[model samples]
Target: MVGLHLDDIDQRILAELSVDARLSLVTLANRVHLSRNAVKQRMERMERDGVIEGYTLRRGSGPSRRVTAIMLVYRADRMRGAGVVAELARIPEVVRCDILSGEFDLLVTVVAESMDRVGEIWEHVSALPDVENTVTSVSLSRPIDRP
Candidate 1:
């Protein structure tokens, strides 16, 4: 969250990518007012510097659905650790998870359809050793971040 210097062009490129991740090099050039080759080089540079994450398609108004949920999993002991988090990340439905503060030690964002599916996922995550308690909250809509 800190120590990152962002120039105007870097900010614009990030904003454009947020709108559409798979934007072609030429399209990016047009949007950023740089040459296609230069845009490609900048993209590669950003990725290498960890400023830009990977690209993925935006799920549209079709049959497919992605349900994002915020989960709080309380462990019996405080040592769930990064290994456990890495294991959870391997689960197909779990988009990401992080160790957090306060009432919950582990916070997770999962993409699953149906309460039934999330219930099933609960079984998988809760069954891990020392996982004593769990709470879940589902997101009804996406929060758009234009930046």
Candidate 2:
């Protein structure tokens, strides 16, 4: 199938939505300096093109802080229908999952309020069918997300 061409205005709208998906159409219109109707039309087109799918709230606060834990999940074999990797993707605790190229095939970064929650994930996910092994690493601090 052919893809839609993105002009400068389309790119601007896409970038703004990426940074702050919660922005209302009126707010986005004002920020982009386009008429509300015009902005609405552009946003609608983007949505139809599968560019803007949905909006989400940025959650969490307090000293508890969000924790990022990396998990290495090994499978019985690589071609067992994604095996543990697909199973891990179903977990809400898991935020990011990637197919690694090494001794392990799945690398997952889980976000939670405490280490206990992270451990719970390891216990449950590692015990699933076709899982060979799991190695975990807890992040001390995030240097990139914040200044």
> Looking at candidate 1, what is the lDDT of residue 67?
62
lDDT of all predictions: 0.71, 0.74
**Clashes in model 2: which pairs?**
none
lDDT of 2 by residue, 59-94 (tens): 657445667899988887764575565466445567
Clashing pairs in 1: none
State how far residue 58 of model 1 sits from its true place (Å): 14
Please state the error at residue 141 of candidate 1 in Å. 1.9
Give the best candidate by lDDT.
2
Residue 119 local lDDT, model 1: 79
